[model samples]
Structure formats: C-alpha cells, structure tokens
Target: MKWTEVQEIAIQLSERHPETDPAKVNFVDLMKWTMALPEFDDDPKHCGERVLEAIQQAWIDEVA
Candidate 1:
C-alpha cells in the first residue's frame, strides 16, 4: 500500500497489531511499521507528517 492509501494501511496495521493503540503511536514508529507491512511498497521520501496523521487517525477509527 502506498502512503496515499491511508485506510488500507490503517486496516493492515490494526490487524497486524491488535494489541497496540494507534492513538499512542508516534510518527517515527508508525512510519517504520507501515514500511514493514508486506503489502507496502513505496518510497519513504513520499511519506510525511500529514500522511502519518491520516494513517493514525484511520487506524484509530478502525479499532474503534
């Protein structure tokens, strides 16, 4: 998933880390984990704070 696929990425993250709280995740770890997803394939340079924030919010929504 690309950085632009915020919801998809959040779904994957929620499934992969069910025990974790998306609201508590910092951007650094968030980016690292996103990059670690098997379906993820994109340039790290393409990601930014806004992308991470969207992903985190989506993940929180997914969990909620």
Candidate 2:
C-alpha cells in the first residue's frame, strides 16, 4: 500500500486510540512488532496486514 494510505490508516487508528499518539507510533517499529508475532511466522504479507490491523485495533482499544 501507498504511504498516503498507510498514513490515513494510521490517522484513523490514532483517532480510535487517543493514547496511542500516532505521531509517535513509528511504522517501522510497528512492522517489527507485527513480524515478531507468532501468528505471522509463516507469511510476510499476512504479517504486514496483521500489523496494520493490530495497530488500528490497538488504537481503537486505547481510545475506547
């Protein structure tokens, strides 16, 4: 996905999780964390999507 799309997704996630501070949420760090997850061990693409979803979910959980 494009950086613009990633940024928009990040913004939406930030809005969902006020405590996450999207400004401070480094995409690279998030990718690293997501890749480290056991569930993503088999697929890099899935890991990436999971990371994005996790970021969004974490943000939502934080704000909710």
Candidate 3:
C-alpha cells in the first residue's frame, strides 16, 4: 500500500503487533515497522511527521 493508505497501514501494524500499544510508538520505530510491512512499497523519503501522525492516529483507532 501507499503512504496515503493510513488505515490499511494501521491495520497491518495492529495485526503484526497485537501486543503493543500504538499510542506509545515512536516515529523512528513506527516508520521502520511500516516499511517492513509486506504490502508496503514506497520511498522512505516521502514520509514526514504528519504522515507518521496519521498512521499513529489510525493505529490508535484500529486498536480501540
């Protein structure tokens, strides 16, 4: 999926790491994990703080 696919990414993250709390994830690790997702394919340079924030927020929603 693309960087704009926030919910999809969150779902992947949630499923991949069901034991972790998305709210506590740091951008450094978050970005790393997102890149590692099997469906993920994009330039790392495209991600910014706002994109990370959206991913984190979506993850929070996903888990809640």
Q: What are the per-residue Cα lDDT tens digits for candidate 1 across 31-59?
A: 99999999999999999999999999999
**Residue by residue across 1-64, what tens digits does model 3's lDDT show?**
9899999999999999999999999999999999999999999999999999999999999999
lDDT of 3 at 42: 96
By descending TM-score, how would the candidates be arranged?
3, 1, 2
lDDT of 1: 0.97
* Candidate numbers, best lDDT first, in rank order: 3, 1, 2
- Residue 45 of model 3 has an lDDT of 92
Lowest-lDDT window of 10 residues in candidate 3?
1-10
Clashing residue pairs in candidate 3 (N, C-alpha, C atoms within 3 angstroms): none
| TM-score for each model | 0.98, 0.35, 0.98
Residue pairs in candidate 2 whose N, alpha carbon or C atoms collide under 3 angstroms: 17-59
lDDT of 2 by residue, 1-64 (tens): 3322444444444544455554466667666644444333444455455556556555555555
Could you give the C-alpha RMSD of every candidate to the true structure, in order shown?
A: 0.4, 8.3, 0.4
Deviation of model 2 at 42, angstroms: 5.1
Stretches off by above 4 angstroms in model 3 are none
